[model samples]
Target: MSQFSLSNDNDDSGRLKIHLNSCYLHVKVTRPYIIITMGDQIYQTSISEYPDGRWNEGFEFSVSYHAQLFDTIQLDVYDSYMILPDRHVGRAEIRLIQLQDMPATFTSFYEVWDKKLSTGASSHAVRKTTMATNVGALQATISYRFLHIGDPQQQQQQLQQHDLDRQPMEDDLIFRKHLQQNRDTADILFHKYEEGSHANMDQLHLGTQGHTESRTTSSSSANTMLGSLGSWFGKGTASTSLGHPTDPTTDDLPTDILNDIDSSLKTYPLLDTLGSWTVSKETNQILRAIGKLLAAFGQGFELSNLQMLSGFAVVERFYQELPREQRTWDVVRDLSEIQVASHLWRYSMASYGWKGLNFIGKGNGYLSDAIRHHSDSKSVMEHLSLPPDDLLAYEFRNSGAFRPSYFVAHDPSTHSIVLSIRGTMVRPKLIAYCNRHSIGALYIVGHSLGAATASLLTIMLLDYMDELQKGQSLPFTLQCFGYAPACCVSLDLAEKYKDHIQSIVFADDVVSKLCYGTMMDLKQMIIAGAEAAQNLGISQFLWTGAAGKEKWKSAFEQVAECRQRCIDSMENPRLYVAGKVYQFWLDPTPKNPTRIVVERTSPKRVSSELILKTSIIMDHLPTNFDIAFRRATESMMTEPREQQDGVLDQEDESRTAEQELKHTSKRGGTDGSPMIDEQYTR
Candidate 1:
């Protein structure tokens, strides 16, 4: 019993047991066996009698408990033929840490890959082909455990102390060493530059001395040399001395010598003034023309503004002819602000993969149809609709790298100008066609990277509102909606623009949580979680059944404690969610898997503590956000406003928004949206 006890094994060494179950192969092989290698040790299994590659054999290997984390086990399957040399069929490598992080008894299928061929075949191509062809799979069970050779209680205490001491020591040593290396390199570079500059100056002085000697016969030449020397020593002396005869002038010096003297004097001042320099409008136009010509020569063609305008006209005419019902002013007024914003947010996401006028050539107003179809699929543009003709202008730009795309559309029914910026990906082009241009309330919408852009643009407009409306009779009113925007501004700026901007963050969305402080906290939390799992032996029970859930609960509690410590130690200024935030998440209770909830929370209330949930990333997707919005809207309609608002207000006052979310999904729910309710069951 003592020997079987994982925490009290007689020997300090760790043992790994592997069971060879079976292999499914594409090609038939006779009497197949497997060769297993781990670190310096190797073992071979006996050949199976069945031709289908079944062994049903078990083997054990001893490993140093401390060193086992870095070790990997390699399995090479071979066919033993009487006449031919044993042929290698396939191989698979399994890292020991992977098995250690799983249940005590884990069974899974691993892909088997053929040895690289000598005939210049790409390994990646071969792997892809093998996967595509359903080549082979090896099914096996792996078990691993390690116990310290000491009293259980004392060993646990020591292990905790060691972990606490070792991690920081290692990280600090590495970081300090890297920082020192950088400082040394920078010092070397600076010294080298300084020495080189001095040498160049000395050479210039020598050249001037020689030139002065050669031109000593003329008084004018001497005066010119004196003038050049004075310019180098004093500011603005050359310009002042040019008008006087007694004073030295620059006219007599050779062009090359005079230019060199002028450049040397200008270099330092240029460095100081570089930040203030701006290109004139004419220069920008010239550069734009040059860029256009270069692009035409490189791509063999260019998209002309005339062609874009024609495509826009066709799309506009097609939409105008369609028998679509226009929204009445009363209906538009009845829609909630968030509902309208969510509709515009769809436009933000649709901007990605949008080719603008390029799709018009497909015929029958393909571009307009595509946008309408996308909006219908996402269930957007329903309440206050904007027709294709209302699309005043659209621009997409990609200068060697992907830049965000934007479209300007007018909703005459609501009397609002919509600017939707798309997230990152692909190239962008521009098109514009407007029958009647009229100013209206400005609404800006964007998602992900585009969201950050929209937020900044809103701030700029707010700051320069006076300048923009200098001569205008009516003041401009603008609102911005950012969906899953990155942390783009300071807490001050976010608070300052709260009235005009709103950021919609989905449950456990990682993008919105990103900031210097949050990232640091996340890093610390990961390290702490890993160490806690190992110390508490929680990893061994992972995926085992009901007992695993109990272990995971304990593990999360420990990680939460560690995460709190990390938060207390953080000193960096955390960038909060911009403006008033509306967060959507699923009801955490098991009985309400499809019920989505919304909370209107402040930026400061959003948790900086990173939660390790699968939804952290998936929740950031636009599709997920769309589903969340739809469900949330439905939930809002069904539930009384007062009741729902009371529940949200109570939840906000009781605990953090994220903490409540994490507590509800403590049973390993992957996503916080109803779209993945099936995942909760499994």
Candidate 2:
């Protein structure tokens, strides 16, 4: 029998089998799982808890004789964590043919490999450490026993376990490679941004060849949250910088925070049972109606104060009006502390997309200078040609672990991508209140820009916990649902925290597709900008009239030129809708008036054609999405079958004359196309 042995070597060890061609075998870690390919066979391990130091007992698995002929083995060790990206700890290569003949048993075959940061670097420099040292090492011992082809009993046993072995199927291989590439690309881009920012900071410090000084100078203590000598990961006193990893600080966490987070991570299959039938029809109808009110509430945020509920009062009244048995959810908080920092830009001279708002730090709110150090994001206002007043007030005072990207704003320069200044002020108060009084899960919901802000805050909180807890997973559970959200994240960040985000999209929602200009062709970008300018009205400005008209005209021209320049430079901005997406579509055919469909889609599948018939403004509103959502959910009650194509075959449609006509070869689907639409062309 051929005996192939694999072992952890250490708590973080992994093995890779090389082919005769000298190509290094590949293996990747996705949190609790590890995927490895040996010879032509791929093996996947069962999900297990993160390992502690040294489980030295070697592992045994079946391998073919041809695999044994392969002469090399590469072992890579990684430190996998939930919140942070996995770190490569160590790697080693062993030439098995040189050790001894494969058939012989060898116990003395061993090697110690030092952990490395990069391929050429010999020093074991950790993320924060400047000097190299023996930070970590791995000692591996491997043995192989070759078996004869005539060992029928051994072959039979191996055959029995074949089903348990997870060979990397075609789809899995493609998807895993894609995810890896996306991650790598994101890392490269972020590092580039960091490098560029550092260069700019140096120039600013040097006064541009001694010709200029900094724009402003303040005490270093003014930016207290910004890194100083004592910041985490910064060089400073070890006692203050490195807290005990086992116990997180209690100052920032709720007493039951750990328990809450742990419980939320556990599976809840009951959620799968939710449908119109699960609750009273009346209750579903009430919720459907409330969806419209909620949309109105979100839209009103730009014009109204946080204290005003707008349509929410109507929603609360409707909930109270529901029959006792039909009340599915008890009204907990009508408008909790879910404050929205409204964003507005001058789309045209005649009118703004949304009206004027106060600029932060000038009789409005405070904006920090910390984000300014990340030079890549400095062009936010210039790219859009937006006035300073248009900038959101949110500022992260501390050095962030993550580089800013599409999640907050369009430009990759120094911009606040997280909470608005108002949100920055209100968030802590809300979080503190939740920790003190939260009896159950914290539910956050937002629409449009509010959705983007909500998503940002959720991650921000997680990072905060990661710091206080020293990598311990937070205890309490929090969930966010964003409706009609614009593109606000890179694919890597999306995949990194896929479990925590969900978005609702209406058919062809224009708002959801906003940030792709950086990814789209220049023609598309120009068209988008023109459309925004036209629809929002460039003449809305007071200076557009005869008084100061010449100056305003020149300013508008410059804005257009700057916009085109920005688009030219943005070759392939990292942007995408992160996490699960629920897409809704309305039936286009007249005969199927009531037919609406909702399909669960990945970020890659979101398309602009779904709502192609509606105006851009109408396509993006939550009010329209709510109507379609209700209709789709109602249709699900009678029709439960999914079509060969993705669209659900609703019972009402299946029972109709239109369905019969569409099923025939002569007349199938609109424009004689297939019933289901084409996938988004990424």
Candidate 3:
């Protein structure tokens, strides 16, 4: 149970109001047709004549359930158009935990953005793409109150014995009136102390304390006193603490694991490329390299969905074809998308890593690619069941996937609607594989959707291992790399994994930021249909382009028109892409063609600009990362080096490092410009 006061200090209060009861959400929009929604619940106002700046007063809101579990709450404002689709004016997104710090009733200002369209005329055709820009401002005083139901049966018993209805009766109202009077008296006494001399401060405190005690004793109702008292006394105490945990005093590395990683490096010299990827700490280099390799498996699947059908055969072939220096990695198991409930989700079990010292100097084992392929026939979801109540607390359950138990910083957060059902089947298999292989350290890399799955797997895997070891320090370590991964966990979970996870983002990659803090709804189906219709045009254009024919030119035009319409209508859902992101931005001005700025720090605010200036799809391709890395390093592909186990001859690419640092430091620059020169060493 909680209360939120949404207000602006500069404006008049009491114009805007909001309330939540049980699972129901209620909203009141004042100027224009303001619609507010959470999940499937929505409340909208009719078209109004009030000009954009006419209102000064605000509103209030209240909810009855435990609102702390929500990761983000967004309020959208729209302007109704007579003939065209509604224009999205702006939005306000607030994390629930952030609101708990303010006074019970407080005012906050929210900025509004106007949709701007960028268009072009190509000789004979016009193209339009819409983007959002911060424009207007709205000031409103908003507040919410939640009624906590602690032990429903006990509450019912108390209510029945008191002969009281749920609503406030005359006696309850009288008691509340006295409580308020006493509170006001305390406030006056406290203020008097501030105005008076220091000699009277102690006297004022004693008087205020006595007044509060008297009020509490007089109004103590066994049935309702606890709730009111808790409210008055528990401000700020119930909220989750802000910010991340303190950094580890020492690196969580062991002697044996370091030796194993060193052995892998010695056997596979290409592993030395890891020194090029930098984090703040030197000990983290091994995990970063492992992440890059795991990311390759995810990128491998993107090569062709057909490869997924081949399963183990394709995995073996993929590894076998790699250069000798890169072939030391092995596929512990291959995961595949599977059916969960009624949806086919992507929770496959593929993890590629070094198999430790026993396999040193020996090639990784591979099953023949020519072996007959056998598809899994059993229903994967059939045996997947939820754990008992005791284990459920650690589990993460979303509209798409579920696990028995796992460590989580927060629950009931938004997950990508496209998340695969395969996650439900992969956890146990991953645990089993790790047990059998005697993995000293586990590292996973996932790109886009695979990144999301990897995140869930990391949490669940740790919890499973912890449970199995009975709180003892396990023999292995776990880390993950998310290359442009979607937001898979709640804000709390993201923060919890901050030290162990690295989410890499390329400049203006729409896929990484597309669904960060948003949810998909049935209403999106309409837009999905529109998007599908546009895809037909795109498909036709692709076919015609492939044939080197002018045929389907009209289809290409229609595709552009459809894209413009969707942008104008705001049909595309903007989901919040979460992670402790590290962005790589292309130099806005290619003055130094060799340099691509790197932002070592995470972004403070997510940019709402989703429109792509170049190829809309190419920004998300795995190859784009290669191009960025090339520009960043200003180096060509390195020739394959001869491999000799236990015979090391290498030098740090110190010259390349020196060249990268020659440019100006631009950390925290805007518009995807150079942020910083990457500088660190292993």
Candidate 4:
């Protein structure tokens, strides 16, 4: 009719409709599930087993279509889902078709996300190789391809160190970029010290080129991670999954999501009479989560390590693999800049403009809790996705596969685990994929782009305590943590996220360095000496509490001295590294600006560097037992405690610093606001 046919529009199923657009769609799709709910990208779900029941059913799905004023549009609904009434069980079959003349946007999504991507492979794959490239004016251009590994051990060590090294450098880049993203967010917490934040705040006035990080000899961790490589892309036997898709512009959304909603479970709250829905569902959810934890426990099922409980096998894996030397370069290798940035932007708790279109007032942890919350609520399953028009099903509980964020659920029993982590900036749409696949034990960890997502989500989670206390929502019980990350939030935000996130801080790592200066002006400190250690900007860099700093300092010192004495220490961070990161904060100010001052009654038996290093290296706590590190140290070693009474504790000192910061904020943020550093300003 009207030269438009809905009959052969898609596949044999009556669900397909033809879109009129010019598209060069040559895609080889092995992946069959059409992910219709998340953002624009579609991901291949990794499952441990196939589902006994339909994955999607009774789930309502929809798509927005604009037909010319009087033009007509057809809605085809095929394959259906079936939910077993009153049993907390369901089944689904999605009838999908090969994509052709797909909307330009859909085709682009296909190229980046589907199994069939550029050249041949689906650009959407983590193992995709021979992908297309888009080098914008941004330096994110790929210069190198792959690095050869003589041995796996060497490569693994390189990978871990590589992550560590690039972590700081990349953080610096993001912080700088953050400075440009709406100046309003740059509000200096210089007074940050006033509100429980202490012992840090320093900056490099624009054009101030006083020092440079002397390409610290070859022994640096950054150097170890890098090995000896400077290029656009780091290729280490690039088989495929090119890491992250370069662009979603050419990606395709799987067409499988256009199936019919099951007839039985049409009501909201999803199920009519879920057998013992109250107890079984709750028990099963915990069970499934615990199984995942056991997966994380692996051999550690017997170990009582609290850190290991988090399922860090991936970190162990990263620490186990990767080239070390190339990590020193300015740009760290990634799946794709846009995907990473987009994901970061999309999930940013403080996203701006059109980027966070659907996230209106949504907190970061939405994805993490979406499934569980929906299961417990009247989730009719919103049919809208990115372009905000499409439906798949009205699921009782959306699969973890539908989620674009990361997740890790643990089954406290048996210590089994399941982790769902999206690679790179794409945020891989984990929920839907997790649903399609049986995640034995789920554990998820993401960085940079992933890190920010995690941070924002966690912050919002703690913030949701109000809802939980009011009984509006079930208390989100997933144990989650973020490390060396940035948040689209601040310390004051803690009240909101009090119950949700645990953050890890690495000493001297400038992860959150860009948030402050004069009063939140990001100067970019664009200058020659900007990279040098002598101009350390610790005041603005250290986000971890001073107790954290002190703890790290003590552990590092023990480890450093242990290693120097040729003592065996597996956890000790390399010494040259401790000094480099610590020294990175050289008193740039004329008067010990941002200096982590030290006091001791014992005549300073141990160097502050060693003190800090051992604390981190040995990973000890309650350093008060040792004079060199504790409050009693001053009286025991170099000077008497009474003699150094003027030297305030970390907290006391922070209070004093804030009294000075108020006068500073009046001046302004970064370059435009002031000409001199705070040491000079104060």
Candidate 5:
């Protein structure tokens, strides 16, 4: 057998350079992922030895020539590295090389081979075979000789920026010019230092035995210049620099690209008139803006389902268009009557928590199995797939144009079942189900307007405590809950119901704090002093059970450390003000805040100890953060529906025992006072 073999030549010594074509790559191609490797395959050559006086050309040739060879890194894993194009791998070329074994890092592969054999310009594809394939036939070493060539096209795709490789604009030119100038200045100074003109330069050039530089006035001037240059470079754009090797002139900007972006911005007018529209009407405009964004960003095939977002937006805008005389951001109105929609669910659908479970074989879980399993939630909305417990939608469903005959009622929202969405209705039905079953212990976890409703319900129940206590009977039910209670409610309203509700605050979820009049600065109340960290009571307040103990402790320490940094930065206390709010529901107290935080209370109808949503306010706690959210939101039922008999639906099983709620105009009573007397019973 002819002794066939691969070779690795590494002899890097004393400022040595090497020349090689782009084909000299160790490319590992798999179907999905392609890895390129640069190795010690280059024979001894110098960058300065280019045929013409093009030293810079030699550098460009080295990088670009190498880059172009990997025009296709199609992935298909096989024995060694085969050059099979259709070999189960994706289309794309990759060049792989080692960091250290490129040149002068290994000995000669061929003992007597000539140094410069067949050395002209040649670059198409590199032949790569594994070490195992090298064997006795081809003696090859599996050294860390690999070059990592990134896929610019793929990277552009990942960024979702279509015009990444497009011609540069004036902005790009400015940014790159700023970058290169700074570097050029740095090199010039380094050259001066080597000449030993500055303070102690000779020592730095030599090391411990040498001097650094002389502190001359000129040196100070040079140093100041460099400092300013550095600042300028940093202020300039770096991430936006997608400059090509062949630098384009300032006039190279594409006219069409600018025109496209200009067209898009025209949609959202920066200066719009504030007119006599009601608050709901104003909200509708904002919802419409968001809908436009969804339509713009999510246009591809995979995200075609996001078109539902458009419908969602329209629905929300329609809801906001509701007259303020009817109900301003009222959850009860939406749930009790399908016609009063301000589809605040627009925000709720996009990112409100745990809504994707509605498609699991027609169940009331979370998301539809389609979405939970599919990448972008299923092609259909999981929530829309689910039937809500609310009965109010029944009337709307009976309407000519807005009927929901598509979804079946394997599960129905009957008034008899007091907790959760017992039925499968469309949007109105779902809301009615939630409202109907949510009479006493209605944990209303919602966002945006939905969150506002949750807040209102929380306030109503707390304000009507006597009514609620009697209706729930402790052995019976609890009232509704909110996620990020809406903006319209005042801080006074939030505080009044603060004792009865539980809130999970996102450190970054500024929605509630921004919307509501005030935020409970628990950062100060709980994380101000270092001494507040070590208190076991605080630990127990946030975490208990064997599993949560260590994490709770660690998170406490992290929070403590972060707080110290904030405290140290006294002048700019907001340095750590970026910490997000988790959730702090109304403290169920009279006993103690800790009792509510720890979820010490047992379920009224069940023997299980309830899980109260509390988190260790720490540096990075995403998993625990999510768990705490669910804990605070567990056992949440949907709104109830009106009974078919036309009497009206009851929220809790014991709801009838409580007083009847007044119409929206007089919900709080004849004086428009807000009360939850309806949820409570005598």
Candidate 6:
């Protein structure tokens, strides 16, 4: 008999007493018995009667304390068929940890599952057949207790044995510490090589040699320290190195590998752009450039400061034509339309300040103030000039980090529900929440990140409109106004939803042009420019500084050539700005004052080339959009009715004429136009 046998042995560490109460099964059996297993020990209960299957019998086992704490007990019920093999009815398992905390006896009904029935089925399918596959429920009582074996002397000896058991673990931890230190040192050296900060080839060679020597020294030192510990434990010496025993050096690299690297450098135009500097320098630059290219391919591209400044200078000339008076124009008087861009701007701004102010509480005291005082009311009410009692219900949901926060307000003035979504906050989770509360007209307004969310929500709502309007008498209408919104939908979707959405993009706002295809084009442009510079043996850095004007000019020419090629090669099925886009740009005609022009343009037309400008970030701000909207509205209001209607038709001719005149005049014009069409071919 094993030492764990239940024979009332005084030396037993502990005992597990289990009571077999009763079991219920779907299928009836003649003879049923349960096999209980804990660690290597197994116990079988006597065969119970059919129909009810109640034994009400108890069994006890002598188990060590470690086994009682750690092991899981499994109960398998089977039917005896005499000639045939025993049929597995069901099975159930319980860990000792579940009953360790119980004061006395722990009694519960454990559901037994038919393992054969559940095989090869998904979790969902298993859930659907849970009732069918549940062979029976076993109601059992479990009791576990520890027995005092000896006096304090024996307990003290056991404690010492526990310490002896932990000695190997402590030794392993020390080894790991030394190993980590070596790895850290190696990582630092590798990092230095990657950064190309090494002074010269001699230093690089010495550093590599020193690194190998240090790694070997550390490995020997660690082994020496652990040698005595290994002997005490009667074990072999532990492996010191985590990886390969010998580190491969540059001299060890195959000639074929070196040739492959050289070939790769030449074949890739971007790699060639870095030129043959030090091996380390070339490798570093190539890696950095490749990383940037891959990132752009994944997350969209960003233009260099030089490119932005160049684009801004070209676009700024248009803004300079705005009359001095109009440049300082502000919204002093209220607009006639309540749902105008200015109102939307105010609503969008108020959404940002929703959490801070107390006046705009759940009860809406400030809302009442707006209704009562009209213009005299201070706070957000002064900015939001809605009609009396027009504000109905409002809700601000900003719970999760990833979830987008939105301010929903009911405005009866225009029979619409206004949803003002806040722009990207710190660590924001991009999630869309769309549900129709009212059958009223829905107007979605957002700037930047929020604008993208609003656009997507509009599409989602449109797709599920039928289900949403199942019980409603009136159909819901969604109109989205996105200010400087990111490209969120494909060109096809944008065209499809043109009538329902409007994207108001400020001049040269970079966010508006950020899309997958445009970014890929940007990557292509960089590579092409690099190739051109490489061919001429000119450094690409010359374009950013005044080290050599002639060199910079040549480099810029190559970049321009690449830019034009990239622009011409743009393709389709790419993410485009959602909705009918209205681009507000400064139009400065020669010999005329600068005027703000709001033109209706296609998403494809706007995203053709990246408008690199210093004001790209600033242009996306709500305050800037507010000022631009006010000025554009003022410009439209002041213009003649006939001119207002014919603006779009005459825009092409005017633009063409301006381009031709700029080309014919000085290549470097006095008015600082820069002759973009002739020089850069934008």
Q: Write the per-residue lDDT of candidate 3 for residues 511-551, one digit (tens) a residue.
A: 65454222111112222222333334444423546542333
lDDT, candidate 1, at 610: 43
TM-scores of all models? 0.41, 0.28, 0.30, 0.20, 0.22, 0.39
Candidate 6 lDDT over residue span 138-223, tens digit each: 88876654423444433444344455446758854654454345434422211101001111111122123332112235545445
Q: Write the per-residue lDDT of candidate 1 for residues 388-475, one digit (tens) a residue.
A: 3454444332210122345555666456666777532111110011101234367778887678778887875564344333334566
Model 4, span 458-540: residue lDDT tens: 43333323322232133323333333333334333433443344332222223322221200011111110122212223442
Clashes of each: 1, 32, 40, 151, 118, 5
Q: Over the stretch 1-682, how does candidate 5's per-residue lDDT look in tens digits? A: 0121223354211112221221111333222211221221112212222222121111101121222222111111122223544332111112222223353233222111111110010001111111122111111222222332355643443344556555346544555454445334312111101110122121111112221223447645455344323322332222113222222332233334344333323233433333113222224344444454343222111212333332223222222222212111111212222111112222233222232222212233532221221112121234434322221111101111111111112113222211111111112222233232343333333443344544454443343334333433343233333333334432334344444443333222334333100111122212222222233343454447785566445544443443344334332111111111123221211111111011111111010011111111221122223323332232122213341112212224223333332232244423221122221111
* Model 4 ranges with Cα > 4 A deviation: 1-233, 236-238, 241-449, 457-476, 490-494, 516-682
**31-112: candidate 2 lDDT, tens digit per residue:** 3333232222233333334343333333333333333333234444555677887665444445333443442333342232
Task: Please report the candidate that would top TM-score against the real structure.
Answer: 1
What's the lDDT for residue 61 in model 6? 59
Better of 2 and 6 by lDDT: 6
lDDT of 3 at 115: 20
TM-score of 1: 0.41
RMSD of each: 26.3, 28.2, 27.1, 29.8, 31.2, 30.8
Higher-scoring candidate on TM-score, 2 or 3: 3
Order of all candidates by TM-score, from best down to worst?
1, 6, 3, 2, 5, 4
lDDT of 2 at 241: 34
Q: Candidate 1, residue 485: CA error in Å?
A: 0.9
lDDT of 3 at 485: 68
